[model samples]
Target: METKIQKWGNSLAIRIPKSFAKEAKLDYNTEVEMTIEEERLIIKPVKYKKYKLSDLLKEITKHNIHKEIDTGQAQGKELL
Candidate 1:
């Protein structure tokens, strides 16, 4: 199917037809990863590997420690 790129506010946007999106199981709020190969733009849905917190914590050892990540400055009621 062919689509035309149009202006959307400050960015260019294209509408994926409903039939195509439905066939690919894509909808609003679905995350997609976009990459450019040679001269073509490829977009595909992001597949996330599910992990449980308990399973993740099992890999932590005594030598491992949590590092503080800077999340910018606190906003609203967030405590430092």
Candidate 2:
């Protein structure tokens, strides 16, 4: 697909069509790396580490558990 380059705040910008964006898993605030290869502009999504709650929980043990902290006396109605 051909996309026209438009002026965007003193820089040239091109809009990626929805179909292409979806195929590349691009969404709002997604980080992408841009480079030039063989006189062609290449845009690739930066892979981000995805964390799962269950996987994180498996690493916790009694040896690494933190003790409770004391904040002196409560200033509000938290005592109630």
Candidate 3:
């Protein structure tokens, strides 16, 4: 697809058509990775990393000394 670079604020940018953006599953504020291979330029969406809160909590508890604190004194002792 051919596109013309136009002035955008302080930087130059090419406007991707709505049809092309929709076909590429791109929306406003979407993050994309750009690269050049030989004479061709490529643009791809960046994938996000997925994490689970429960897994993170379990990992933290595995190494936590205060997770089994039963009393205020025990907690205070652990704190000190």
TM-score of each: 0.65, 0.58, 0.55
In candidate 3, which residue ranges exceed 4 Å CA deviation? Answer: 51-80
Model 2 clash tally, residue pairs = 0
Question: Cα deviation in Å at residue 26, candidate 3?
Answer: 0.7
Which tens-of-lDDT digit does each residue in 4-80 have in candidate 1?
A: 99999999999999998898778999999999999999888999999999999999987896787899977878884
- When sorted by lDDT, best at the front, the candidate numbers are 2, 1, 3
Better of 2 and 3 by lDDT: 2
Candidate 3 lDDT (Cα, 0 to 1): 0.82
User: In model 2, which range of ten residues has the least summed lDDT?
Assistant: 64-73
Model 3 lDDT tens row, 1-80: 78798998999888889999998888999999999999777888889989999876777644564555465555454665
TM-score of 1: 0.65
Q: Would you list the C-alpha lDDT of every candidate in the order shown?
A: 0.90, 0.91, 0.82
- Between prediction 1 and prediction 3, the one with superior lDDT is 1
lDDT of 2 at 26: 87
Model 3 — which ten-residue stretch has the worst lDDT?
68-77
